[model samples]
Target: MSHALNILKEVFGYPAFRGQQANVIEHLVDGKDCLVLMPTGGGKSLCYQIPALMRKGVAIVVSPLISLMQNQVAALNEAGVDAAVLNSALPVEEAQIVEQKLLAGYYDLLYVAPERLLTKRFLDLIAQIPLALFAIDEAHCVSQWGHDFRPEYRQLNVLHTRFPEVPRIALTATADAVTREEIIERLVLHDAEIFLSSFDRPNINYQIVDKINSKQQLLSFIQHEHLHDAGIVYCLSRKKTEDIAAWLNTHGITALPYHAGMSPHQRALNQEKFLREESIVMVATVAFGMGIDKPDVRFVAHLDMPKSIEGYYQETGRAGRDGQKASAWMVYGLNDVIQQRRMIEESEAQTQFKQIATKKLEAMLALCETNSCRRAYLLDYFGEPVAFTACGNCDICLNPPDSWDATIAVQKALSCVYRTGQQFGAGHLIDILRGNQTIRVVDWEHDRISTFGIGKDLPVKGWRAIFRQLIALGLLTTDSDSYGALCLTEASRAVLKGQKKIFLRQQPEHKKYLHKKQLANDCPILDQGAQQLLDQLRNWRTETARKHGVPAYVIFHDTTLMELVRMNPQTKDELLRVTGVGAHKLDKYGDHLIEILRIA
Candidate 1:
């Protein structure tokens, strides 16, 4: 344990271990298997990294994405650690050289994707060398029902079967009780210890808004709060990602599109640009962020609804990774709900898969419509219930919405569905209720129904919210044919018969987000001269990173720079005292940093 602490300070440059990091590292060093469920940026890598450096031979890390592996390996190299990655992205000669180094015991850590790890040739080669430990990242991918399911991950049970003596650790950022169990079962870690950290990201402010002209709403949010910040915008479809990216770019936002539809070269190029540059928005689908380790993402906005709470949590978790203030902003509407349900109904997955997926989606909808604390609901969903009802960080706690007695509105909507023969979509029904004599309504003689014009007092947008809530509350469902036609569910009977009352949440008027909130990461503790020093230090870091062919944050995180400006360390010894300055980093960049601080 003492030696581990020394390494944490000497190699990793952290003064102390956070939460269960120390315990997890000690357990792995003791040659025991375990499963870790730490949040993103909670120091999960150090659990195995310290053990890998202290243990006998080499640690084999099974990752899902080659880009992720490259990022980690590059950061490790910058930290003066011997790390290498073997993936299809490498040239044949480079791969062969890495393999040769592995045989010669040259690297302390080697990262490989599951597909490459399970290859017989690679497995056979590892068998001939001394093994240290096996670390599986993004272990939620092993669950068959997980959001990011990869079939190859299910085959990782062989690690324990082949190398029974080696300690193995499976790590993930998001998983429910069911998915968690599946991870343990699939990874064959029944006897392993479990370390579950709190899933709450206190640094993130949760905000959900009505989808009123989604593109414009998104533009407004970004323009007001994150115009000059780095963020991610997630779309539901490939074409939407591209369209949104193009739209944002035209609006003067430095945005790029990323999805599976793009060619490998283009995708890589866009991703590289996002990583290398600052103040860029990445418009992407769910495929873009599994292994992204970028820590400066100020926000993650969902333009459409995700398939499940797990997916929502995973995607939103990418923000505020550096423990800075970030936002998880979303705009969902009736179409997003219908679209998610229709996709599930249309999928080729089996009955049980669909059932669980439906339940998960319901939870997500309830979360969106809830007038209570959003953060508490999120934490409770993962079985980490908080004692407090209001977290004060989410929009609900900041500005509570009103829950109107919507029973009459709901009854009117349900009756209209019944009188219209339950074959019409919400748009047509809303039109008929608002007394719009549309050609289709007139052609069908729908304007003559008693329910027609009944809801004239309510605006179109108001009715849209009520119907959206009804569908979300399971009082209504789409037709089995995957059409947009609204059909009353069995649960709708009570409301239609006036036996049960309904209360629907009404979105509060847009609160003008303050300009200070826009720069949540801005450090007020630093005066004008100190702020100038920070900028100069950033310029130096950027040049150094460019020379090293790595991202600026890889050289020193923004948080570290803030600390440097505050501390103003003058000597090499004083510089080493600051956080994130390990021995190797101190030796490599300490002189430059000292000079920068000295001049100030």
Candidate 2:
């Protein structure tokens, strides 16, 4: 234990382990298998890292992306640890040298993609070396049920069969019960202990608003609050990413587009800019942020709704990773709901898969439309207990929306769907209810239907909200055979028969909570001189990062810099006492930091 604490201070420069990090590390160091569920920036890496250093042989860390491994290896090397990567990104000679060094026991940790790790030649090489442990990062990818599934991850149980005595630890920032079950089954970790932490990021403020002029609303959000702040804006399609990026750039915000459709080189370049530079927004689809190491992202904005609560939680978890204040802002509307359903209906996956996906999508919609505490609902979805119903941190808790009895309105909508031959999508139905005789409605003579104009008292947006709630409530479903036509489900029968009452939440107006309160997560603790000093240090970091060709956060995280600004360390001893400033790092950069502090 003394050895572990000494390494924690001298090697990693942390004063103590956070939450359950020490317990996890001790279990792993004792040659036991375990599974860890901690949120992003919760120090999951240290759970495996210290064990890797303390154990007898090299730790083989399984990662899903080359970029993730590269960044981690860079950071570990900066910490003066002996880390190497074995992936296709390496040149042939370099790969051979890594293999040679592996056999010679020169490396304490090795990062490899799952594909390369599962190869027979690699397994054969491992047989000749003394095994320490296997660290599987992003372990949720092993679940076929996960949004980011990798087929190669399913075959990783071979590690257990081949090296029965090696300790294993699977770590992920997001996973529900189902995904966790699949990961354990697939990874053959039935005997492993489970260490579950609270899946909550208190510093991240969650906000979802009705989508009226998404582009303009997004512009207002950035201009009003997050101007000159680094953030990410996620779109649902490749074209939307491009469109949004171009539009934002034209609006005087520096933005870049990234999707799978872009060329690899262009995508890499954009990603590099987003990481190395400050205040650049990356408009991308879901392809951009699995293992992103940047810890200073001020916001994560979504222009579209993700398909599942897991996906939403994981994406929003990216913000405020430095444990400072950040916002998870999104705009959702009826179109977002329809688009998600249409996607699920159109997928070529099996019926069971579609069923599960639809269920997940329904849960996501519930999150979007809930009037209760967003944080509590999200925590409940992950089976975590929430002591309070209202977290006072989300949009709903801050500005509670009014709810009205929508029973009669819901019945009228269902009757319209039934009378319209169940072949019309939301637009035509909405137009019919609000008494708009579009060409198609008039061509079908549907204006003569009994339910036509029955909902004339409601506005178009109000009717749209009701229909969205109906679909979310399972009272109405999109027919898979037709072109996203609304159809009444078995659950709809209860509402139409007056056996069930429906209530819908109104689209709450943007109360300008952020602007009114000026809720900058990173602002409260900073004064004028401290802010300038932080900026100076950031400028120095950017120059140093550019010279090393690595992300600036890799040198020192924003939280560590904030500590420096707070502590104002003047000597090597004082600087070394700061979190994330290890003995090795102090040896490398302490004198320069002290000189800066002295001058300031």
Candidate 3:
């Protein structure tokens, strides 16, 4: 443990372990297999990394993405750790060099994709070298039930069969109970000790708004709060991703589009720009974000609902990774629910899988509609206990939504559904309730029904909210047989018969809650002179990174730079005391930084 702590401080520039990092590292050092379930940016790497350094031989890390392997290897090397990566992206000669180095025991940590590691050539090479441990990153990929299931990950059981003596560690940022069990079973880690970190990311404020002029709302979010910050905006479709990216660019935000539809090189270049630039926003589908290791993402906005709570959690987890204040804003509408349901029903997955997917979507809807602490609701969904009723961070807790007796409104909506023979979706039902005399309404003679026009007091948007809440509460279900028409379940009978009273949030006017309060003092605030100093330091960092052909963060993180601004260290000795300034970094940049501080 002492050795690990020393490496952590001297190499990674952290003074101590966070949460359960020490315990996990200690267990791994003792040669025990382990499973770690931690949120993004919870330092999962340190759990395996310290053990690899302490053990007798090199550590082999099986990662699912080439970009992720490259990013980790780069960061490790920057921190003075001996690490290398082998993937298809590597040149043939370079791959041969890495293989030879591995055979000669020249590397401390070796990262390889699962497919490459499973190859006979690589397997033969590993057999010739002394083994330390196997670290399986993004371990949820092993679960067929997970959102990011990779078939190659399922065949990783060969690791246990071929190298029974090597300690193994599997780590994932997002996984529910089902995915967790599947990871353990598929990876043959049944005897591994499990370490579950708190899934809470307190720095990220969760906000979900009813979709209204979504593009404009997204623009407002960026302009008002995160104007100069880096963020990720997620869209459901590839076309939407491209459209939004172009839209954002026209609106004066530097944005890029990324999806599987684009060429691999294009996607990689866009991802690199997003990582390397300070304020570039990447609008992408679910294809992005799995391998992103950026710690300073200020926000993650979802223009559409994700497929499941697990997906939502993982996507939102990308924000505020540095433990700095960030936001996860989502705008979803009734159409999103219908689209998700239709996708699930029309999917090629088996009946059981479809049912599970439906339930997952339902849970996501529940999170959107809940008037409680968003953080608590999200944590509870992951089977973690929340000690408090309110998180004081989400929009609901901050604004405190007002609930009204929506019993009468719900009854009218349900009655309209039943009167229409449960054959109409929300649009038709809402039109019928709001007394819209459309051709379809008159053609079906729906205006003549007793429940028709009864909901004229509420507008279409209000009625939509009521129906969405009803669906979320399980009082109403979408029937795929009827083309996603509204159907009442047994729960709806109670509301219709006045046996259950439904209290729903009174739909706010103008969507004011979507605007989050700008956090004051979240980051280090500088005086006029110090602010200039900070700017100069950033400029220096950018130039240095350009010279070295690396991200500015690889030179120094924002937090470290902020610390330099605050401390205003005048000498190399004082600069070394900054949190992230280890011996290697000091020797590299200490003189230049001291000169800047002295001038400022």
Clashes per model (N, Cα, C within 3 A): 0, 1, 0
lDDT of each: 0.92, 0.90, 0.89
RMSD of 2: 1.4
- In candidate 1, where is summed lDDT lowest over 10 consecutive residues? 514-523
How well is each residue in 1-600 modelled by candidate 1, as lDDT tens digits?
999999999887889999999999999999999999999889999999999999999999999999899999998898889999999999999999999999999999999999999999999999989889999999999988899999999999999999999999999999999998999899999999999999989888899888989999999999998878999999989999999999999999999999999999999999999998889999999999888989999899999999888999889988989998888999989988888888888899999999999999999999999989999999999999698999878889988999889899899999999998899889999999999999999999999999989999999989998989999899999875838789999999988999999999986887788534645545466679988999999999989999999999889999889889988998888887788899999999998999889898
Per-residue lDDT for 292 in model 3? 84
- lDDT, candidate 3, equals 0.89
Consecutive 10-residue window with the lowest summed lDDT within model 2: 513-522
- TM-scores for every predicted model: 0.98, 0.98, 0.97
TM-score, candidate 3, is 0.97
Which regions of candidate 2 fall more than 4 Å away from where they truly are? 513-518
lDDT of 3 by residue, 305-424 (tens): 998999999999899888889999999898888888889988899998998898889889989988789999989988998899998888888777889998888888889999999999
List ranges where model 1 is wrong by over 4 Å. Answer: 480-482, 515-522
Give me the candidate number with maximum lDDT: 1
In TM-score terms, which candidate is top?
1
Clashes (candidate 2): 1
- lDDT of each residue in 1-600, candidate 2, tens digit only: 778888899988899989999899999999999999999989899999999999999999999988889988999888899999999979999999999999999999999999999999999999999988999999999887789999999999999999999999999999999999999999999999999999989888899988889999999989987888899999999999999999999999999999999998899899989988999999999998888878989899999999998888888888888887888999998888888999988889899898889889999999988989999999999999889988878888888999988899999999999999899998899888888888988999989998878989998888888888888888888876787789889998888999998888977777865632646443656778998888888888888888888899888988788889999999988998799999888998898788777777
Which of 1 and 2 is ahead in lDDT? 1
